[model samples]
Target: MKKFLQKYSEFMRGRYGVDDLFYFLMISTLILGLFPNFLLKNGLGLIRWLLFGFGIFRYLSKNFTARSKENAWFMKVFRPVKKEIKFLYTRIRNIKTYRYRRCPKCHQQLRLPVRKGKHTVVCPSCRHEFEVNIRF
Candidate 1:
């Protein structure tokens, strides 16, 4: 096993192995292939296989620069989506205890403690102040 791993690592020296795009492709493939629609299933099945095959090809290919560029581009598109999902998840987790607000100037999300009556809210990111009544 040690010998095999060493050999495999050596074989993959100049190749681009795993990256964020690879994981995203894999997860998207699994999700798209999970639905029950026959047409969608077949189409997504092909897409999934293509993505998997492409990832494997990338892993074995020695074109490291192009593969790295592709991964960077994918991350440029994927980070915001990931952040939004995380924000939603945290908001849901703290739904009853806190309220989520966005700063009008900077569009930054703020988590305020839930309370009754009127209060002034400050946007930490932009240093903008605003007032809101938390009647919950």
Candidate 2:
């Protein structure tokens, strides 16, 4: 059993690296169609499906004998949800776009949008008041 497990892990390691694994998992999650039961319960299944579809595209582009331009063209033509999926994927992939801001009055950590500007922000956790100066 131990040998079998080790061999399976090795095989997977060779066939699919970290990125491929992530793509596979995301696709499987959508295929199972159980996001509503656990991960997303607010009718975000379409978004999830669109993201998984994008993952399928990315995975195929990497492993299959297809040109990058072709893959990009496919994605451009499909354009799942046009705005929602793209927005969600962008937010998920962009770590730099998400920042942790602390409220001055309560010191509670708040998620602030990234950009260059000052805006009045409210903390839901502690009901704190603060101003966020986002610089790009």
Candidate 3:
């Protein structure tokens, strides 16, 4: 086992092992795998296989510069979407404790404690006062 791993590491020395785009492709393939019946019925069964093949190609390719550029571009495009998903997940987890509201004056998002009633609120960014009603 040790000798095999050593040989494998040496073999992979100059190859692109993995990156963001590869992970994205692999995840997309897995998600598509969940609906095998739909994919086969639609004649799209090869889509996941193609994605997996491309991911493997990217992983084993010797072109480091191209792979790095593709990974960088993927990260640049995915960062905002990742952030929004994280924000939404956190908000859902803390739904009972906090409420998110946008300030009317500056349009800034504010996290306010959950309270029921009509109350006056102040926007910290623009220092604008407004009334907010929390029903739940």
User: Which candidate comes out best when scored by lDDT?
Assistant: 3
> What TM-score fits each model?
0.74, 0.29, 0.90
lDDT per residue as tens, model 1, 28-55: 7677667638636466556767877887
lDDT per model vs. reference: 0.82, 0.63, 0.94
Residue 122 shift from truth in candidate 1, angstroms: 5.3
10-41 per-residue lDDT for model 2 (tens digits): 65552323353344448676565754765465
Q: Please provide, for model 3 over 24-70, each residue's C-alpha lDDT reduced to its tens digit, 9 standing for 90 to 100.
A: 99999999999999999999999899999999999999999999998
The TM-score ranking, best first, is: 3, 1, 2
Residue 81 CA displacement from its true place in model 2, Å: 41
* Prediction 2 TM-score vs. true: 0.29
Q: Each candidate's root-mean-square deviation in Å? A: 3.1, 13.0, 1.5
lDDT of 3: 0.94
Which clashing pairs does model 3 show?
none
